[model samples]
Target: MILSGTYGELRSNHFHSGLDIKTQQREGLPVYASADGHVSRINVQHYGYGKALYLLHPNGYTTVYAHLQNFAGEIQKHVKETQYKQETFEIELFPEAALLPVKKGELIGYSGNTGSSGGPHLHFEIRDSSQRPMNPMLFGMDVPDKKTPIVSSVFAYPLGADAHINQSQKLTKLRLIKQMDGTYKTEDVISYGKIGIGVSAYDQLDGAYNKNGVYSINTALNNTPKFEVKFDKFSFSETRYLNRYTDYGYYKTNRSKIQKLFRESNNPLSIITNEDDNGFIHVQDSLDYSYTISVKDYKGNDQTVIIPIKGTKSEILNPRAIEETEDFIYSDHATSLTKGKFSVYIPANSIYEDIYLNIKADGDTLIFHEDVVPIHKNITISADISNYLEEDKDKLFLGRLNYKGKPYYTKTSRKGNKLIAYVRLFGDYAVVSDTVEPVIKPMNFSEGKWISSQKELKIKITDELSGISSYRATINGKFILMEYNYKNDVLTYDFGDAINTETENNLKLIVIDNVGNSATFEAKFFRK
Candidate 1:
């Protein structure tokens, strides 16, 4: 099997917690239990790991199979009954040990393109008893991997205010040349004071063109180990530390992850080992240093790059300047600022470091700095909405504008005359309104039609502004489960549920948007 994503790979806001195995661009592939275990838990949702199953093995490990089409045999029966019992499409259940047991290699479910999946694939993960996801490759799961990792770019950064690389205070990209022996070397770098290194690399397995994450990276200075990190396992709580592990500011602008060899003071990621001075190299006058970085895959294939550094002090050509602003946010202290009708509150430790931020209000929009800064926790942004008419208050909401200046919904709440939104991103936000109601249209059978031969019913629902928040459907005055696939904007119901008891049935569906705008549809169909 091939992989689309790797464990501990860089993802938005968090690390990829599992391996994404390619399912050949189609669904309904057979999925088997990894070991003889009981069905511990099941989760069905419109987002996240849709139709996921958890199996608890006796060896203190839990194997998770996510994005499944349907469960098999008795497991499918139990899930259907529970959904009807709860009268909801999204449900979570913890089955008893005696309820559902299966042997290893037994059929459990079929692969699917559900949840937030980009395509048809299985997101597989193995967790310890403490629920930390461990690399499945460590447990003897193997794929054909004889290829080495590719280092695309290398950069040198001045760690301190006075440090300089190549007589410049800005981060410099080093050009590399490949040798006949498959090793890389960079030209001699003239530097002074302390500096850190960053590398962009990816791995590709045998017969696969997808660029995946590497297994380990090690850096040495003057033949002494400086920093080392391996992607074996990590806790979910610490995944957001990825923003700190890499150069967050660079990623925000360049759209690439360049993992820094040096660790920040507040970075608590547990993946690094055997480090000195947090991997920062202090260059002294008249001293020469040889730095090497080794990137390797899980199958022992490695690629090394040699960087020669010479400690020579030169004239200060370009110096770094600190940008100062009236709003100075201390990382260790709670701060609140207000401008016009807009206000923002940042809690202690929400930011990685103390920095100057530009916060101001332009008309109804709040410009809360750019996204170059990484936020560890949610901060509050409030806007006074007393000026809006009472009739339009129900349609009012809070949204963040993208680069194109289009506003998208952000979860907002109304408290008195204030519209509050807790956000982790630093961007342009505005108190906007979504006055459009959701669109609900029947996909399979229309009104006053006989659909006796149809085995299922389908309907398409969509929203233009705040997006669909909740939807409910009833047949013959009784609530029936209608599974929603947000990926396709379709709601499906199986005829086998037998909720329709009479020959002539009336179906009523109500879909509500995020800002309380609702739309209703009613239809009549005859089914045997």
Candidate 2:
């Protein structure tokens, strides 16, 4: 049976596409097949769903196994052979129809924290034959769940000029009070001209206390549906628009996940199940109205909240107002700053909204939003480049330093007007590279030889810059594939092929980095 550890949440940018399976405390737990299927796809990436496998079952469903520790016997052999031939660490392969078949209850792989996973667990997913992800708990996974969801936060938004929250013309958080029973009630009555709501909440399974995202959310006004969204499935193409579905500034600053209790103008999360009267409810003059919101998981467990809004048409106490300025030019292609430390030049017709910029000078560092445009504009930092570099002034490049410890190249040049930086906005950083070599560590068997029946090999690779690019392996001097899963930075090789009825075999492994640095390991082993 398919089990649910967490339900998907309809998030901004993209839908929470699958259920996360708790792996009982740690990694390396055996994962079983849900139905008869063939291994259709295998992907080993540096980030985001590392060491993932896709199986196509007979019932027009495709199951995904992500953050895997290692594949099973025959499957491991096939993966290793390809890795050796390609001589690379990251790979994506679509196998033939009959390449690797599986039976229900059969072992497919081991669960681990890989890719973009934040902790140790199995990131399981169910998709249609078309590869669109669906909520796995819909398949009747037997996970016990009795605890109701906790409504940790609520946000009310003023969508239009006349809208208000309580009595103010700004976004406000409603205080919640839990009565003797488990149900939650609002502490204050809300009054507004016109407004919408947003919520930030999660669910929990019985066996595992880990908090998981909720599966669906629905809202109604006076028992008439206003909006609804389900997290059952979504396409990756819509993932980035998450900003449209959330309070971006709130998430960027506070790190809280707040699903805009109400849809905004032109927001694009397609999972929205209901949209009525522009998703804004009017609080009629001197009238009382009822609002209800329901949150649920994939197994049908649910929680409902009732809100009574006593309407009073009132003037705004302090109106939120922004003064329009003509000194700084705003256009679809670029934002010209007359008073900031940086000026951004975007390609024509690229900006979606009038950007509220926060630009400043911070001692040799020039920073700006990287996603507003698609052109090469430079941030002329006050620092003198002659202090940090050799005579090749024209060849000096600018780069965005990433948290992954890799510096990505950006097209930049220094001229009299300013330092021109050609970049795509959002998450760009200034970075430089180093010539240091990467470090590799083999956990068990030494560099020479060993005698044992161990079926797995484990190694760790680390680099200061540009990170580990790829890795390869060989058995008895013959090529073997070593899948490098960057999430855990572990290189794994199965002994299915290197083993024979009789005694001894030699194994060699090599790992390489983006800067062409390399490391090698050789050993001898015996398998009975």
Candidate 3:
């Protein structure tokens, strides 16, 4: 089946990894297998693609069904067996190719909203043999869509120092109006020294009420196709840069994502189709310029917006003439200070852009709404812990400094500008560590003893800092695969050809932390 969502666009950690299927705003919809295959992988996470299943088809392709409520009868049994055997709430299991087979059109799962999903829907995708995700719409899943996308907002930004918008070095959101002919026109023409354009738009299917992200956007100057970017595919490796792709402050405060149709030099998304030295369009003396942006979706529905600019060079305003004087006051209970980390504090009326901010202390975290530039001030959390924790506090490690159960490493150190936390209006700024080792404890076997004859080895692992990075297993010194379930912190290895009838076997597990720290454990076991 073809996917309903497009690729690219900034997403969490990674791009939208797969197609998010709309289940008609409800859960428990029957999900059919796209092709004949074996149940290769099943994952249940608390936040992402909750209760997802992977089918490895014969055509060298794999189809993923995510946000599922339940699996089919046999598949449910298999999941229960593993869950009961391992005793955990979340799991990632890779069964042998022959263990669970499926046919095309067979019922595999029921759709629901499980993970980080906002509501009820199924996130689907198709990947090649090597597990690289591809657009599922290429396979012919039919989603009838003819409506063009809607442009909700338009913003113009001043890029560098001395740059100005209409002779004023400040970012502005332009007012746009829709004409009776289904076209958009700006209310006031823009004159800028050097700046870029950002757009906020979304797509919707013909019969569904859900607002979805667009698939492609192209900007042209004088019909020359200056920039073209298609949201076809992106890796999770570059998803956090979504901040750079949009008006960060606007999104932080306004709750909107403005897709940057123009490329900034420092931006890292690989989907930029056009580039220009000066992203701003400079209209000469009494010159009129035409700008057009075309948007499309997976089904080829299109929308075009035309913006006409009447540029007239004018003198810039004096910086002091328009400067608004403001004072920032911090309340006694408003700031939480942490040592040896980055901290930010925003004084009232100090920010012009919308920002997402986290303010917390003593394990209580609160997310504030986007603040306008004149109403909020940023504050950094820097505490002088040398006088508080002393030199010996480094060895008395803090455990699970919880901000909603997400742990952050806290060290008492005197470093340059030791601000550990900052309150900004937009973007996620949570503290995580790459220098700490993960906690791995054997659940089924002690440090020196034979495990039960259950034909499997299981262990529980956790990381209070950056979480578990990677792990490797060896049975009698041969490499074996261990599936990691981030939710339950459990790792399991199924008994296979690598382990045969023997009086004793040396099962070794070596787990690497996110920051590259390693921990090893060995135990003796026997299998018939």
Candidate 4:
């Protein structure tokens, strides 16, 4: 199978967690089960792993198939029946082991660009007995490769306030030089105290040209192993640790993944093992250390980088000083700030370390610092909107203001005068109202037309301000299932299951945006 992604690849706020198999940029190719197993779990959603299936094999392993355009004949039948019974398009189902069984290489579903997929590909995964994702390449999946991993960038980081790199208290980017023997060497650095290293690199296979995740990274000093990291297996619960695993602040502005070699106090990623100094290197007063960094892919191809560090006596200069403000919020404990009609709560452990937050209130907007720092969990923002007009209260909700003065909708709950919004991203917050309704237009069938020969009904729904919250479709005053594709904002309904007759039918659709703004569509069609 052709691959587009690698397991445990560093993604935004999480690991890739699976391998993406290329489907030729199209859907509807038959997907087969990997081994003899029973249908254990199936989940269908508008985002994430859309139309995903899980199979539990007797060998204490589970396989997953995701981003399918449609399931096989039997699987599709069962899913439709369940959707109609529940009156909802997005649903999760689990059949008893005896009911749905499959042998090795049996057809299960068809590949599609469903869920949060950027293109048409199948995201396949294999888990161990504990349901933790394991590298499928380890299970004899042959991936032909001869190219070595590419080292794009390398960095030297001063770990603490006492440390200095290149005679300055800052992070320094090292220059890498490629040698004739196909190896990388970074310029020698004069550093003192505790220091860490980071690298930005990727791997590529033989046939596919896409930059995939490196399988393993090993760092050594003076012929002794210092740290080792592998992308073999990991737990889903620890996936969010990816933010701490990488240089989050650098990635926010640069959009490049820089994996830190040293583990932070809060980064509890399981992929790192066999660490000597926890991936940190200490330098003596007058000495130089030789370092080696090796990156490899599953195909046994590898690349190496030689880094030399010279110890120099230097003092930390111009360290970041915590600013004092009227509303300074510390991250160690629960911190709250209140001013005007705005209040915020930063829960304990939501932040990785002690951070000074810049908060203020101007007019009706509450500024909770810019989006520069990384937050581990969500902080609640509350505003008193009792002054708003009673008639417009339903339209008013807590919104995160963007640079263009537009509001990004969040699920806001109100109790009396307090409107609360729990957000993970740090930004300006305010009470914004959205009164414009959504727009719905038919795609496949038209008004007053015969759709007797059509297989499905499709409608496109869109909202300019607040995003779509919920949508429902009804036929003859009864609820009918309408599958929503959030990527394109299109809702589809199969005529075979819901409209299986040659008669006149009345259809009604109701679509609502985030802040109570809604629109309705009704039409009549002759189906034979």
Q: At residue 10, what lDDT does model 1 achieve?
A: 84
If both were scored by TM-score, which would come out higher, candidate 2 or candidate 3?
A: 2
Tell me how many residue pairs clash in candidate 3. 40
- Model 4 worst lDDT window (10 residues): 315-324
**Candidate 1: 10-residue stretch with minimal lDDT:** 313-322
Descending-TM-score candidate ranking = 1, 4, 2, 3
TM-score of 3: 0.62
lDDT of 2 by residue, 289-314 (tens): 87778888655677777677777778
Candidate 1 backbone collisions, by pair: none
TM-score result, candidate 4 = 0.96
The C-alpha lDDT values of all candidates are 0.91, 0.66, 0.63, 0.87
Q: If both were scored by lDDT, which would come out higher, candidate 2 or candidate 3? A: 2
Q: After superposing candidate 1, which stretches have Cα over 4 Å from the reference?
A: none
Candidate 3 C-alpha lDDT tens digits along 17-95: 6767766678999999888999999998766788899999888888888888778879988886676466554789999
What is candidate 1's lDDT per residue for 212-287, written digit by digit as tens?
9888999999999999989999999999988889888998899988999989878888888669999999998789
Off by over 4 Å in 4: 315-330, 498-500
Q: List the candidate numbers ranked by lDDT, top first.
A: 1, 4, 2, 3
Identify the candidate with maximal lDDT.
1
TM-score for each of the candidates = 0.97, 0.77, 0.62, 0.96
